[model samples]
Target: METLRWQDHTLYLLDQTQLPLTETYLTCTRWPAVADAIRCLAVRGAPAIGVAATYGAVLGAQKIAGETTDAAAFGDRFLAVCDALEGTRPTAVNLHWALARMRDVAAAALKTDSCTAVVGRLEAEAMRIDEADREINRRMGQFGAAELAQLGRPLTILTHCNAGALATAAFGTALGVVRALHAQGLVRMVYADETRPLLQGARLTTTELAADGIPVTLITDNMAAWTMKTKGIDAVIVGADRIAANGDTANKIGTYGVALLAAAHGIPFYVAAPVSTFDRTLEDGTGIPIEERAADEVRQCGGLATALPEISVFNPAFDVTPHEYITAIVTEHGVLHHPDSQVLHEFFRKEGI
Candidate 1:
């Protein structure tokens, strides 16, 4: 499924916040609307957010194109739009990476082209980023499937949150690997964690897998350890929001706990993500900013209150898994086994990142 679509200066996002119940799309003609979608979780996931932000930049440039003829003025306003979109979410490195690429394209185009022409360049770049993400996911799927197939049996995989086609441009990161394995008839069943605060797993992950005819069993977040212990799970794979230089990963809240469980069971805990999700500047997960969401998100489920109105809630949208707990970091380039700072550095350097 295409998470984002751009046509004639307008961007369309598959409204993820309404998934499984209502398959709706949000039309965004302006940059702020796109930013709002990202902030509101109408469009989410690291790679999908990156793709949306790029198109958001294109929309911003198109708006500037109409308001100003001067290239310098357009450049300043376009940058302000990028800044707003980047601020929508702090944890996803893909958002920052996507915006940086758009900024570079604009900076270069403004020197030799008109504001209108710069808008064209930005649009083209946005499309390229969108297409590249889908291709990257496919490659990551192949690499991860090849690595996991070594288990030498039909495998039962456990996953947290919703890292499926709905979460990316197309295919997925962790779920893409699952799809690849299933295609090879190597998958027995998929166990999905009903990610709380928002049941992305129950509402989104299972929905995606079911649509593709993949056998999936949904379980609550707390049931993960017992399930792994009794169900003979061979691997645990999840997607990342941001990966630090030391291979420490930040993903949906409760993912750290899942990693710890996978560790105790001797199951290979894998993180599947594109290279763009890596923030090489941050030496470890501590340096990665974690976005804490509204208290109501914890106090209620699906807008039905589950707690007292005045009760306090600590709701962090994501958590960091220490590098040691990760068995491997799977990427479009290759799989990094027992990833560490030095190994990651060497891997990226070899890949010319």
Candidate 2:
């Protein structure tokens, strides 16, 4: 029973905004609370935020389900909820993508019998999406592990940010590959970037990875270049929030910098994600919108009360990794190689998504 779940009429979320300090769980009876949670980053990461948004839509539907039970009215309220949640965070495509998919479910449900029935149907559909997300993550791990295994030897890898189970409904995308490697006895050592400001890598990524008994070394964001050059890392892997049709990726802040470093050292750079992460609408990396965070994240910094105030910091939530810099984009379907757009389009055609 993680913070993000549906039990009875309420929604549970880990309250990520208060993380690494006060462990608080926000239970939402109203759908807007869920949306607020996402906007405020009480619940975050592309997949997890998406899942929470879908559930938020379900909760939204529940709130709109009055005794009158009009299909048209229900649709109006449902769309409103989706719109509100989508506005919470524009950078993560998953937010809009999930809400839109859930909206489609609501649209179809309206054609059915009663508003109550439609609400029930929406809950069922949202639950299915949640379940499917978890399954896709598991399959993603398997596919990624298979590719990494072929590289030979127990491999030393470097990763940025936290893309583990906490970020998704399941084992995760990029970090999933590392977990899979460990499970298969192919991992040598892992170097996690202590992603500045938010410190997702240090807080959540390392916490989860260490719990799994994976040998993880935490390094500052600037230390990536040093580690990659001196540590003789064999490969670099990351998860993407949105991958354009041309194979460019938008991931956690600092990923692009890390990718550039990996390229210079001639190390293999892999982007592991589900097919859902692929955005055929966007032509390339340049088309993918990079989110600009507030200056407070870069300037003030958190956890200052317990320590000296002398340290200054700069923080951005995510960075975009160009497709050309990526050696391969591994999905559950298979490994996609160069001529990136063509390979991605082939995947789209093969899946019919």
Candidate 3:
């Protein structure tokens, strides 16, 4: 299923908030509508968000192209669109990374082309970014499947949140590995955590896996430990929002706890993501900004309150899992076993990335 699509100068996003219940698409003709979709999570997932933002940039350019003939004026307005998209979500490095590429493309195009040419270039770049994500996820799936194959048996894997196609341009990251393993008859079952507040796992991940004909069991977030202790979980694989230079990963809120559970149970914990998720400038996860969501998100489920009206809440969209808890980081390039500052740096340098 396509998470985000661009066609005829308009963007189409599968509304994630209504997933598994209602399959609907939101058509965005303007960049502001795209931004609202991101903010409201009608379109989500780090890579998917980045891809959507690129199309939003194209839409932004298209809107202003007719009004501005001057390249300088067009560039300023385009940068504003980038800034607005970047502000939608701060934790995902891909959001910033993708916008930077868009900015660079626009800047270079403006140097020698008209505003109209700049718009065309931006559109082409957006398509390239979307296509690249699908390819990267497929490659990453292969690498992760290879790493998991070392178990030498059919594996029962546990995962948190929705890292499947719904969360990306096409194929997934953690779920990509699950699909690859399933293709080879290496996966026995997948345990999905009902990620709280948002329930992306319950609402999206399980639905995606079940639709793929993969065996998936939905479990509550609190049930993870007991399930791990009794269910013969081979490993825990998850997707990341951002990875610091030291390999500290920030993913869905309960991921850190899942990592700790995996460590306690002697099961390997894997993080599957493309290289773009890495924020090399950040020394550690401490520098990675954590986004705290609304209190009502924590207090309600399916538009019904689960807590008292006046109760206080703290809802962080993500949590960091230290490199020590992770067995390896699966990427399109390859797998990094026991990733650390030196290991991650060496991998990037050797790949000449």
Candidate 4:
């Protein structure tokens, strides 16, 4: 099933924050509600949020058209809506990319005569973006699965965070790889890091795996290296929120530690994502924007306090894993081993991206 959909001019999100316990959806008829869902993590994941923002753009146009027929008025309010959605999340380059695409569509449509045509074009653009994301996830899954198969064993894989379908418009990126590998009888089981401060791995990843009948074990964020030693894990694969030109990857917090552990263990560490996740403008991850969230998220989880109310916390939503630690990056375009700017440029050139 698709994680989100557009129906009757409303964007329907699966309400991911209620996952594992509740199968619920949040419908947004207004663009601001879409931004709120993204900000609250009700609709999350890089690709999913990107798709959400695409729909948000469509909704913004629709709302403005309904409010008034004045072209200048519609243009002003619509641009403000784009600003709001763009500000919702920063770590994921996909969010910005998707919004920019929609903005381009709006700019072009505005040059023409009709408001109705503009709304229709925006909807079409959003649908096209969502469909492209799903296709990319599928291809990334296939390419990534084959890469895992090269290890030549039915492997026990460990992953950090929730990169399953719940984290995308449909299919997935990282878990999509796992699904593809499992289909070929090359997977033994999966280890999910509880993903502290959010519990996405435990709450969402395990839920997706279980629902799909993939064997998944839950472990705390601190248990990664120990789990690698004790569980005889064959590889570590995770999703990326953003990837720099030189292959530095930014993912959910604690992913760098997971990569470091994999490196030390002599286990291959892989990052699975579509080309849309790659930020070619940034030569390395140091320049990639890092988003710091609320201190309460670190001090408390599930509404249970883990520290004193006055305790200080540094809660970055993501961390960058340097390219040296990554064994390979699996993308829809195929695997790029030991990626760098020159290598990525060649890959993009070959793919005509």
Could you give candidate 1's per-residue lDDT for residues 257-352 as a string of tens digits? 999999898899999999999999998999999999999998999899999989999999999999999999999999999999999999988989
**TM value for model 2:** 0.93
Cα displacement (angstroms), candidate 4, residue 342, comes to 1.8
What is the alpha-carbon lDDT of model 4 when measured against the actual structure? 0.91
Error of 1 at 143 (Å): 0.2
Minimal lDDT window, size 10, model 2: 306-315
Which candidate's lDDT is highest? Answer: 3
Pairs clashing within candidate 4:
none
TM-score of predicted structure 1: 0.99
| Model 4 TM-score relative to the real fold | 0.98
**Per-residue lDDT of model 4, residues 1-353, tens digit only:** 45898999999988888877888989899888999999999988999999999998898898788878776677778788998999999999999899889888888888874777888998999999999998999999999988888888999999999888988988899999999998898889999999998899998999989988888999998989899999999999999999999999999999999999999999999999988899998999999999999999989888999899898899999999999999889998899998877778899999999
Q: What tens digits encode model 3's per-residue C-alpha lDDT throughout 6-88?
A: 88899999999998899999999999999999999999889999999999999999988989899899999999999999999
Check candidate 2 and list the clashing pairs. 3-12, 3-13, 252-318, 253-317, 253-318, 253-319, 298-315
- Residue 353, candidate 4: Cα error in Å is 1.6
TM-score of each: 0.99, 0.93, 0.99, 0.98
Off by over 4 Å in 2: 1-3, 303-316
Q: After superposition, which runs of candidate 3 have C-alpha atoms over 4 Å from their true positions?
A: none
Clash list (residue pairs), candidate 3 = none
lDDT of each: 0.94, 0.82, 0.95, 0.91
Output the worst ten-in-a-row residue range by lDDT, candidate 4.
69-78
| Ranking according to TM-score, highest score first | 3, 1, 4, 2
Clashes of each: 0, 7, 0, 0
